[model samples]
Target chain A: MKILVFVKQVPDTDDVKLDPKTGNLRRDGVKSMMNPMDANAIEAALQLREKHGGSVCVVTMGLPMATEVQKKALGMGCDEAYLLSDRPFGGADTLATSYTLAKAAEKIGGYDLLLFGRLATDGDTAQTGPAVAAQLGIPQISLASSIAVEDGWVYCDRDLGDTVQRVRAKLPAVVTVNGGINKPRYATPINIMRAQKKPRTTWTAADLGCDMTKIGTPGSPSSTKKVFEPEKRNTDTQYLTGSPEDMARALADLLENEHLL
Target chain B: MKSDYQGIWVFAEQENGKLHPTVLELLAKSKELQKHNGEKITAVLLGADVSALADTLFSYGADAVLLCENEALRSYSARPYQKALTQLSEKYRPSIILYGATPLGRDLAPRVMVSLDTGLTADAIDLGFDEDGVFYQTTPGYGGKILAHIVILERRPQMATVHAQICSPIEPIADASGELIVEKLNIEPDGDYEVLETRSAEKSGESLAEAKVVVAGGRGVKTEEDLAMLRELADLLGGQLASSRPLVDNGMLPHDRQIGQSGATVSPDLMLNIAISGSVQYQLGMQKAKCIVAINQSEDAPIYDIAHIGAVTDYKKLVPALIAKIKARKQ
Candidate 1:
């Protein structure tokens, strides 16, 4: 029942905007935190470890600052944490990221399950978990609301478009849990202090023996260099005032003229 | 990496004998791709008893339909569907494959991409080739701020899951026909996963993205009663009722009616936004509306920046009055 939860650090708010000059996220007033859904993944892993009597580990792939997420996971009861960080890992897309993670999983050795948040807040692709499972050549159950393990099998209640399916897969499977999975527990002050002493390690692409051609920008087949300004609708709104009725009348007139009435 | 894969494909997604709506849209887009590279258009369908769907696929512009049927694929357990599609892909060697950016597509396509050892762009909004004749997968990414035209320079069978409503579906021809290639694998290996039980879930509010008129509310919409008032206006205007994510999370409205990055992408003729301050996520799903009318208590709400008509007043008073005025005009 050793569970590995993969989390990511994302901008704290959904209101994040890109800097027009740099074509990158504007980090002036924003803070980075563990992606909200990943907390549920960590919670699911910690709960499973509590029941099955094994250690829960958390892993994240990003810059060195991504250890913030690892520490947060540790404070929330994860037993071990690792950061997959290095220069070569920069500019990796979901494919390269999943490949690097698969290599890390192989390097870590011996885990019954791999868990992920349903999606990263910033990326929003929700493709990495299934890709990692495919990379590992293992079974995967995604969009899970609940997950349970028994006798070397992992069962999950998965959310599909028109049905909720209760599915079970063998050990060494991957599961991506949706935000509705569970209410993540808050970290206690004592646990936060204890987390400082937890066994932590940082692995680079070289240390993971990652194929240099497949670890970063070179490994990522699809590339996006076309950054453009989002289309803006002119906002010269003609304010209709006087009274509610007057405003409504003006609006109705506008709609009628626009052939929308 | 680019040796000899020849066909352009659209995944013909169906359930219980009915085609997913986005399938038609994907086929329409794939036809545009076919014209670009001189490839034959294909509709690759997978199901237990979906042979009859080939006719619909042909009518909607598929030059051929690759139907892969197996009992294991009757329900979409990721492994078996992934295996079947992957096997068929290797055998057929399509040069370009497109899927609808749906939950099912999102679940299945990536695994197949990994198995095929190719790159896939998720939720692409457009597709085209550059001056160099290289394919570009266009999507709104980086929190919807930048429109990225991504390129897969070296992969065969370049793949992407296209956003719904990104393209207009081609007009279907009557009694159209195409080459129907039925593939039944010799061994439909069982997956490690088992489906023990299933119960029906909800889809987004009946094509909210395709509505001609959309009346959307947000956090200012407090309760079901308030929603009902908005619903009244929607019904009067012959449109659909939509809400920003807050109402959906509060359980007052189902996920189908939610409008934002995490939910459906809505493009309507007229979008009447009431009380929603509009987060980046919410605005991205919309912003395609031909007309927007914003009414909020605060004059400084960001939604007003893009709204064609603005009312810096309480929605309660403004909405009720607007409804009354519309009724009078109709009479």
Candidate 2:
């Protein structure tokens, strides 16, 4: 079995500055990191590789600088790293994104399982994984909290609400992992040395056989009209007094008065 | 053409056979937005045999309910739901659409927005339209450090997903009526993804969102053993236990039990904040608590900024006494 883990390089949401003119997040000068959740996906894939004896290839779609992300994945025990970078792939939304990734996955070819974080922290949309599954015309299990392989198939325990949902899918499916699946492993010293020498193969829009018109900003349908900082809330807060009993009674009264009780 | 945008839409979120309360809340608020702006409130309900959920939608202020029922949508999958909703929004062209910021809604909304070529504002705390006919969606931005406003100027239907309980769910009126359109779906000719089975959470138990009394511990709780006191207090109050981001980081509680920005945003009736400094991230989660009581040794802790009752006593001593008082009241 061959496993491919999808990783994205997002601006450290902490470092991303708001563009005063466009109101969207400023991409320039912001430090970037592998989407935090994708680290867990890479970890899950490495464990599967160790147990199932398969090659793990980590893939990402971003700018040229994203080679650092691929290197990070390699250091974390991935057998190979690939990047699908093209200026045309910039500003692609989830729909177009899934299409481009599906095409790249087709280019990578012969993959049994695809792994993704439930959502990228920077975007927090949680749409790309399922969207990619839809584009690829495969089975997908999302928010997977635990996973195991048995009898030529995978069983996933997904956390939905308060209960764990046990789901099964055949091999060669896409799985989006939520947090707490497993603690991501730190790169060993030897692996860190090995990552620098490991060659990173790159793919462009043409390499993936994607339509140039729909690959990036041109293909994206949504546009950000304005982004202003959120307004501060200025509500009058009243502090209650006396013992617990008195405070409780006063609180209940306030709730009733506010008609919230 | 003055934008030609006409109506407000609600993605009526349903799980299993029961409808989510936040859907009704959106309807109520949508009705208010409609009344305020002379617009119409339309609801989109997509599920298997979900028309049954429509009757209540009218009472809650929707001018019409659009029902799209399909077994393919029996479980909440991003593919089919997004496909159907994107088609509906394009066809009818609502001016604004609202979704509850539940996991399902969060997943579905973005996918639909992607397909429709529109942007979405997630975790919006407040919403209203401006004089120029653009929807003003407000959300906590900058990692809870600041609030951000998003405006969809060129987009046809401005989209937003609000956390539940920020707005009140109004009781449905007895006699409200509009067109009931049953939309037929024509999804992508061939879909790549399929949902085999979905595990639904049991409907019972004290969910953090619905808990009345939430005893929350912060970094000051110190250790896992300290949480037992919080649990005891929660048990006495017939409530649930919650923790701030610090406790989650400390592994004292799981992420789901976390009550703050990165955790669950909840609006309980009574919340006890134990040794919490009330960072904006955590406050964003519990701002809806009806009566917030803070227990901290510091007099100027940020938790006291919004707390209705604040105690400067040490949580180590105050916790046991609070539990004892609740236990005595229960007996």
Candidate 3:
């Protein structure tokens, strides 16, 4: 079996700093890591490969630096890595991104299964995976908290609000794994060392057979018109001190006067 | 790329034959949208025995209701809901469709959009429209790093899912008038998907989403012992306990207990923040809290700027005192 996992490099959310003037994420000098959810996707694929005796291919489309993410995935036990990086792929929204990924997945070929994180940390749209599946015209099982593969079929326990459902779909289907799907294993020293030597196949838009006009920024229908910090609430600071009883009385008094009690 | 789609439809989400809170909220918001755009709030209720709620929907703001009740639609297993919703959208050709952004909506809405080959904006925080019937939808993105403006042009029934608690429901207009249109889909239920059984987890006090008072903890709480005090204060005040991502990452709390972009967005009436320094990620979640109360030793804590009430004292000291105060007031 050949399983494909899609991943992306996102600015380490903790270290992400907005330029005070521009109110946009400061990308330069900001550290990037594979999206945490995508890491779970890679781990899920790696685990399946371990069980099913298959090769796991990690694929991504981003800037050249995103190749580092592919290396990281390879270190984590993926067999092959590919980076479909090109200037044309920049500024793609979920639709364009999914379309580009679909084309790239076709280019890589020979995939029994497609796995994706429920959503990317950077975008959080959760649209790309299902969109890709739709564009590929394949059955998709999303929000899969747990999955089992047997006899060329994927059976999944999907998390639906306060309920779980058992879902079954044939192979060559796309599955988006939620975070609870599995605990990602840490890469050992040997794996990390071997990963450094793994070659990352680089593909441009042309290699993926993507139309330049419909591959990236221009292809995306929705755009971020503007980015601004949410308005901070203007409030007066009132402090209450003393014993719990006293503080409680004061709070109750405040609440009563404010008509909230 | 403009497509001809007409009417405004709300998916009247129901479970066990009762409407969900989000359905009412959507109807209320849609009522506002209807008045502004000269459109009507049409609701699509899909499930077994769902027509019973059509009267309630009309009271809440539905101008006309589409009832698709079937035994197969009983439990909401995505495939059937997607099929039903897609069929309704195709038949009515609603210019806009609103969903609650609940787990079911999040799962089913996108699939319907995909099946219909249309565009959908998920987890919309707010919705507005222009005179030309173009819907302007807003949603938090990049883990709440930014609010992205989404417009589904060239697609019929510009779809959006509104996050719960962001919008308040209006009291149904007394004796308000609307038409109740019951339409059933002709498709048979595919038993390929089955709900073997359903069980609901017991929810804790005041779901953070609906809680009027919320107390959130962070890494500054130091240890599990500190969380005891935070929990005590939350209990005394009749609120739910929330936390920053760091605490959840550290295994101090579950993901459901985290309050941030990734977890649950809250708009509590009163938010009691303990030992949490405000990051934009955290702030974006609780920014809508009516009155924010912060207890942190740092006078320079970012939380203080957004808090309506704050104490520049150790949370260790503050938590105990607050708990005691509540206890005494009760006595």
lDDT of 2 by residue, A167-231 (tens): 77777788898767887888777887888877678988888889886678776645444455434
The sequence of per-residue lDDT tens digits that candidate 3 reaches over residues B1-331 is 2445667899888888888888999988887887887777788888886676888888888888888877778877666777788787777788888888776777677667667756677777778874565578887654454565677665566777777756677887887667877776776665444444445523444567888888899768768789888887777777788898656544466556778644678898888888787765577689889888787776766677788877777767656765665566567
* Fnat value of model 2: 0.23
Error of 3 at A159 (Å): 4.1
**Which lDDT tens digits does candidate 3 get at residues A66-125?**
877877898898888899888888887666777788898888888888998887766666
Q: What is the lDDT, from 0 to 100, of the residue A120 in candidate 3?
A: 71
lDDT of 2 by residue, B83-149 (tens): 7887888788888889987767766676666566565776776777667655687665434444555
| Residue A31 miss distance in model 1 (angstroms) | 2.7
Q: Which stretches of candidate 2 lie over 4 Å from their true place?
A: A10-32, A150-153, A209-212, A223-229, A234-261, B1-6, B32-39, B75-83, B86-95, B114-118, B151-158, B183-241, B244-252, B260-284, B290-331
Off by over 4 Å in 1: A14-30, A188-190, A233-261, B1-3, B202-242, B245-254, B260-292, B295-306, B311-331
Displacement of the residue B100 alpha carbon in candidate 3, Å = 1.6
lDDT of 1 by residue, B1-331 (tens): 4768888989898988899998999888888887788899999988888899999999999999998888878877777888888888888898888988877899888898888877899888778998888889877654454567788878777899888777778999999998989887854655587889888765645678679999999878887787888999998888999988656543467656778744777789899999887655577678889888898887766677788888888888888888998898889
Proportion of native contacts found in each model? Answer: 0.72, 0.23, 0.34
Greater-TM-score candidate between 1 and 3: 1
| lDDT score at residue B39, model 3, on the 0-100 scale | 77
Q: Place model 2 in a CAPRI quality band.
A: incorrect
